[model samples]
Target: MRHAVVIIHGIGEQKPMDTLRGFVSSVTRNQGTDGKNIEFYSKPDELSNLFELRRLTTASAEDEGRVKTDFFEYYWAYNVRDTKVQQVLTWIWQILFRWPWSLPKRIRPFHIAIWFIIFASLALILSGYDIPFMGEDQPMWIGAIGTLLTAMLSYLFTGYVGDAARYTSPSPGNIAERQKIRKDGIMLLKSLHESNKYEKIILVGHSLGAIIGYDIIRNLWSEYNTKYVDGKYKDQLLKFEKDYAQPENVALNIKPYQSAQEDLLYQQNDGGNPWRITHFITLGSPLTHASFLLAKNISELKERMKERELPKSPPVFEVIKNINRFTYLPDFKKPGRVLHHSAPFACTQWINVYYENDYVGGNLSEYFGKGIREHKIKIKGSPWLRFVPFLSHTHYWSDDGNLKRCEASLAILTSIIWDKKMPEKDEKEKQTVQPDANELAGLEL
Candidate 1:
């Protein structure tokens, strides 16, 4: 069976296939001296239909019935257009104007440097003596430097930061922008599923793309939530969920939870269900600060989750026995239990990886759910460097010689994407996903 890797890129003026190419390059090049020699081939992107957006197809071991993966990018930067300076200004007002006490605790310390930058920029702008090419009092060198700095800042504010501001804002225009992105994402997934080529779809979202990925899964799962085939094998999956929903078992290991999720996913597929996305992996994701980015506070974020607007890991469980966080539709044509709209994570396992020093990414299990396997790692740094950012967000993969954190991150990713082979009826399958140790072992935070 072939697997599809749909990677959603972060903010910025990212072109089609820009992220997928870089990501595929890193994944392939870092396979270590041991492991399968995977080769990548550029194939036609059927979904995008754009020459710039080619699919990265890897040569898989089809002879041995080994699952191969195809990588596709969900490019949505085109939807965020005509980003006005007013949008950035408004977002700055919303974020910089807030007091430390009002900000979320996790994001509070991170905003100190942001506040300093804001004040420093204001000081420079308000100071008439520091005018760029507009004022006569400024020296030629000062004016030249000021003009260059203006151009740089303009690009940063409009292109890079504008994406987050436009998407996260609740304004009517922002809502429309978000809707378009989500609709396009849903369409892409639907097309992939309908193609009937992939048995599984793995979503890898980086930075702001993580937020988009979460929205896509939460929304798309509703279309297939109630779908089921008549079968007597549903009780096992149901019992697993019921037992997992207990308060005592809330702090359980993620491996067992992930394994159960993988089982339930294939069961749905075997029963003719169309939902095939089994794993969602986020790297350097900003969703770690949901309260600051998505809502006003922590209470509102949890409220949204409880209201079924946001999907949670170990989804919101009910006290009822048979309908443990699921909808029991007795009046349907063929009566069976169906997953609730907010229970996408009940089947799709969320695996988040972030550098310890990355200000944008942090532990998400506390906010999203307990079932999320949040891996905090350190990459090419001294132990005391955890307090610094040092552009760690951009260096998730091993771009340099340091494969310390990259190995650990790739281990989790490879383990999930490669997946475990299914057992046959005659004899139990002993084949397991054994990625190279050199490619999958490293220090953890």
Candidate 2:
């Protein structure tokens, strides 16, 4: 099947239909395919499908109103997940591609949990006895339970509860609301699926649009596998089942990991059958650093601090260890992994586009400033450095170098689409590191 590309705009930004058309033209000018061969769609068009679910079932005025409300909530939650995923993805890319030695600001929540667990284990070893509050007699068991409970509570409190309003505010409430938005997007994609004219599908998103793209790809893959495969892809199916089998899975399934699935999606089966996606790209995404998204204003800061009761004497060392076990480990001189959003880190199949200088037009920095305020940290000269040379966040895509980088990145993506052989890495350089500019220039494209 021929490949198709879908372009989605960022929040409150102009749809990139025309700019994408130009990009396609530029790409095809030196390549084989023409611009028309690439399919382009806008975020609104894709999102509009989510709204159609309201008609799927009849309801009284109150019920219908509730449904609408629920849909918006889901929409916002989906956005939060998308943002997280983008930041995480960016962190991964920075670690792997940009600065392998330098850790990305965002650390996976799972990793954070491990860090805390290690500390908790140490605390138990040091105290020689489990603390009394855990209701366990054995020190080891007490430490383990305490660690688990504390980690769970911290995750629930910090990861979700603390951020709940942020996710739900733009659209809030229950599953019905979320389902409506998802249904809208799904319905739209279904229509596109029915067309069947395009063989390859490329998904491009910015910010929340990127999150939605992740959800669509995941749901599409799930539906396709459920309907088409008959245990042939059992291994892949098993992983998905393990990951998405619970009620919480429902939330995670629709969240940013949907984007992360792109990494696992293209893995080849024993029969050499690979899950195929034409391409995926995200621009100016904050998936790598999510602290940017939390409430940043003084009022929001005071409220969050009050809610968490920061003055509660810094979680007991034992509690701190337990909480740290699950949360992203904080680097005193550097921002925590919370900064790395998921979009860039989670992308396995597609090349991610990022800017060293601008991120969604300095919105990330502004948002991050708010988060810093909550911690009573000064924004200026803070550990999280802003190092933009000349470009602001919004203009990254328009810059000549960035545009070239995009082209180079897209070339790599195109190579993947055609199943072209990728360049082999030099074994001689196992211990040596390469510069980012050279790496970009050395792209096979």
lDDT of each: 0.76, 0.36
Model 1 lDDT, residue 248, Cα: 35
* Residue-by-residue lDDT tens digits, candidate 2, 32-56: 3343232322223333324421211
Candidate with best TM-score? 1
**What does candidate 1's lDDT look like per residue over 1-445, in tens digits?**
6789999998899988778877777676534235644688998888874567888988776564546689999999989988888889898788877677766566787678788887888898788554445566656898788789988888888898999999999888788899989998999898898898987899999899999999899889989876755533355445555556656344678888887777677666655567889789999888987886888877898888778788788887665533444545434566355667778888888989998777778888888888899898876655544456636777665545455546666677766665556443223223223234453222000
Q: Model 1's lDDT to the true fold?
A: 0.76
Pairs clashing in candidate 1?
none
How many times do residue backbones clash in model 1? Answer: 0
Residue 128 in model 1: lDDT: 53
Each prediction's TM-score versus the true structure: 0.85, 0.37
